[model samples]
Target: MHPRPPCRSTHTFTIAGSRVAYDRWSGPGRPVLLLHALLFDRTQWWPLAADLAASCTVVAPDLPGHGESPMWTGCTPEQVAGVLARLVESLGLRRAPVVVGHATSAPLATAFADHFAVHGVVTVDEPVDLAGSGPAAVVAASGVDRVPERFRSFAEPREDPGLVAAYRSWLDRPSTLRPVPHARHPADDLNPPRFTPLSDPESLASRIQYLL
Candidate 1:
């Protein structure tokens, strides 16, 4: 069995007058930015983050108006994506992050990739609407997939107004993300091979590795 994955610690950064709070677990390589579903906080990703920490840095941000993060006067996918871009920029990345958005956040992931230099994008449980979001290069993680029974509630596509307002831009916009000429999942899989993330998290984690 593997040792326990690193625990998360909260930190905040100000971007354009808004305070963004995030949970971070230091590791190596490109940081993995974990965006939880609208109804849940960053802690929802704790189990998966721990498993991923050993492989690379894991960062989970509280969606604005949810968890420790306060609501932004204007919550748009581009706005939130900017905040996330700043967060990723703060990581001092050599390459772009593999943005993972869950449920409704999937569109937001595309928004991020649309505006930033992302290694790739991964939508968990939620299929990202690529029409208005993302790099053209898209592929299924051949071996990784799905949700855990308990996480079903969190995976539901439900969120409060603030989240809706923020995500609407992503849903409505036209595709701005540049098509990646080529993209695919990385060969590496989570170690220990037994402990899975939230919804068979290992499978999802393997997909995230595709970009890493």
Candidate 2:
């Protein structure tokens, strides 16, 4: 297991009656805000946070009801986006720092870019469409109460068992946010298609070289 990064000071701000918690890993460059998917807390970004913080100030926040943040009274995606917009404005991030989202957070990232000013946006394994026939279809087909189970059969054991194990552990945790009522099952919110293998380390290294 990787060592946990030292806990940073948390700042709380109110949005629509809910108090949101965020921590900053200060560095001498532009800011980058990291957002995690549903059912995950801010700590899920620890591995990437440390690496990114080496070059830039990194801010990771627990979205409305996730992590230690307060529960959100409203459940629509727009409402969630509003809270994020407020958080960004509160911090006075005027340079339009990069907003990165993972899993279900891809939509939120796009929403951020669409509704707010952001320099760049990155999404990892987020569904392209929330109401599409992808994950939601699987949920409807399986008739399962929880949606995450549908993807279980697709998870292959990688060389690094620890990483795979860690992901599995996260899947087992209960979500802090009030579940979206659109899907009957929890997993239904996830994109049914697996993340592309192009995101693997080897492929990513090659892509980075090309970008350079």
Candidate 3:
């Protein structure tokens, strides 16, 4: 038989005064919200979302300024959380669905945990350093090496520490922020792509499967 197609669809909604676009992949178990790292968009979650759709629903949204989402000037973690909270409501996911974030978005995940009903938070690669209160700390701790060419110019500002601190304050429970470990970067694939959900989906999906 041919490989099974992933049960997925696209949707748009107004949140925080901007229209946001997202992909919803349906399955059978609990729901999950996937947040992409800085400069990346919801599409980064496709491989893992498709895989996980075999067992659960995965909702991946392009945050305020990325993907099909309108350019939301002055975007803040709080504003992002507010938009996501509304998105969850719009999608009618049960209260406290699990949320996952990659790289810089990890703090956004924490911000979601801070403001919305969430069962837990899962992070992939380079979680925001809780002890760190600023951008330098984020950069120092960032294990990522490459940026998709289009995003290179904004990378520095995106890693701003104030931005990191804005959400790190919300990750409360240590147990809730789960990290997916990678032994080494894939040599051939390295631009070096720091976000594993894009660079190493199978490995990332296995970890997410455990959560599901």
Candidate 4:
């Protein structure tokens, strides 16, 4: 078994006029940034972050408007991506660290790879697509239109195939798509899946290692 690392502490950074709060477990080698799904906060990545800290420094931030980070306007994948890009630089990472995004935040992961100089990206429970399907398609895809407007705003991209193509085009870097076993459901926004990191840290960590 890997040695149990110490508990992480929350740190704050300012980006785009917002206070981004994150948890950091200091380790060695390349850093890893964990971005959580909508509604949930950075604490969702605690299990995965702890396991990865055995090999690398892990940073999991509460995306704007999630957890302690507050936002005054509607959130978009591009806006969130910008926040993450700034956070990495604020941490003094000389190179782009490995980025991991889960659920609806998968697009955010791709956005990082598109805009930043990242080593690689790992997307869990979803493929790398900018989701040009728009709000209606997102509801249909999730099998539920009951989600709040805020969730829809960020999770569902505009109905612009050109934008989707643009995002797909920038994926010149390495990326891995790992689906959670038996957790692929349509109503992801209404009913999020069980915490994979906490429930299956070993498998998740192994996949992340594969990406690294």
Candidate 5:
């Protein structure tokens, strides 16, 4: 599914005092909200969004301080989730959105589902229990350099030291999530096919469609 980049419209909206910059690609199905991992910005979801955009209205937002968004003042996961919920509400999707969160955004995704209206949620390469383990652990868990040389170039600038340090308290904070009615797609299996969202977005997009 290496297709051309779909048309997108960049937007800025304020929710809970945090002004967020998001990219929206129109579609007619249920909307899909794409949340990138730590360090990376909304561009990380560009390809995946394009694939999903044929059937889903895809919305990718620069998390707080990343990309074009301003710094986020919220500290706790619940607070951030609340802001995200408000942001999604502003989209006025015809149906509830299916939120796809990658890596560190997992907790925030679940938190959003815990208290908001979501059709479903998908988490890619989620680093479960890696929070508060420090930087070396973060790198080891991320395996960012193992990707194709071409993608590595895109993955580099995202590893900013200042941005990483600024979000330290984010990983350490106690996650405030309540278990939702969740049923795993085969993609959630222990021995499923190996794929990074960037490396195999079409397959991931298939999994998202199956989940829906």
Candidate 6:
């Protein structure tokens, strides 16, 4: 087995009036851009970014409205995709970097691939059908946010105090959390790993290496 690569130094940058937070584990080559899920940030790729960086430059950007990126008003997948495209151009990527998107961001990645040229695209465990419907529609139709209300309706009989407290804090501070609706049914938002192209870290790294 290959040894794990060392984590590269992290950095942050701003573009389009938004703070584009990223971690540059390596540099000066085809940049692998990672777009995380709505509920997550750029750090989600921590499991694999460094390993990929060893072979090619890796740049994972927290899409606007998530992580350190300033939330934009009326942000849509298409708009998010446009911003990412611009980011690639601004950075002067040597080659169209491969984009790896997770969960909800997968659709945004698809939109990017459809509109912009890229070395390759990898979307992991994303609910593409759900994403294609858009968050607003999901909220309106399901009476909850992005995920259907059925998904988030269950009450925890025994909850971890820490998690409960953290959630409470998140709810108290509206700015801390994205104001998306909850899913009514958990399965509606959850996709099986088998359906995705990259379900595990090894497969994901292989795909990224191929793109690089």
Model number with the top TM-score? 5
Model 3 regions more than 4 Å off: 1-6, 127-193
Regarding lDDT, does 2 or 3 come out ahead?
A: 3
RMSD of candidate 5 to the true fold?
A: 3.1
Question: How far does residue 2 in candidate 1 sit from its true spot (Å)?
Answer: 9.2
Instruction: Put the candidates in TM-score order, highest first.
Output: 5, 1, 3, 4, 6, 2
lDDT string for model 5 (1-212, tens) is 43336467889888557888999888777888888777777877776777887787888888877889877766455776777777777888657888887767777788778788888887766654565565555544444545565455444435566666767765654434335534334445353222266667777888777656
Query: On a 0 to 100 scale, what is the lDDT of residue 25 in model 2?
Result: 73
Q: Per-residue CA lDDT of candidate 3, range 164-207, in tens? A: 44345433224243343322233413332265664456777776
Model 2 misplacement above 4 A: 1-3, 128-212
Residue lDDT tens for model 2, 80-101: 6677677776766465667765
The worst-scoring run of ten residues by lDDT in candidate 3 lies at 180-189
Q: What is the C-alpha lDDT profile of model 1 across 54-148, one tens digit per residue?
A: 77888899878878898888777778899889888887766677777764466677778878888777664443343333221111211112445
Best by lDDT: 5
What would the TM-score be for candidate 1 when compared with the true structure? 0.71
Clashing pairs in 3: 134-161, 135-161
> Poorest 10 consecutive residues of model 5 by lDDT?
186-195
Q: Write down the TM-score of every candidate.
A: 0.71, 0.59, 0.67, 0.66, 0.82, 0.63
Pairwise lDDT winner, candidates 3 and 6? 3
Compared with the true structure, the alpha-carbon lDDT of candidate 4 equals: 0.60
The CA lDDT at 29 in model 5 is 76
TM-score of 5: 0.82
Per residue, candidate 4 scores C-alpha lDDT tens digits across 108-154 of 77767777777777655443332344433332332224433423332
Q: How far in Å is the alpha carbon of 122 misplaced in model 6?
A: 1.0
Ranking by lDDT: 5, 1, 3, 4, 6, 2
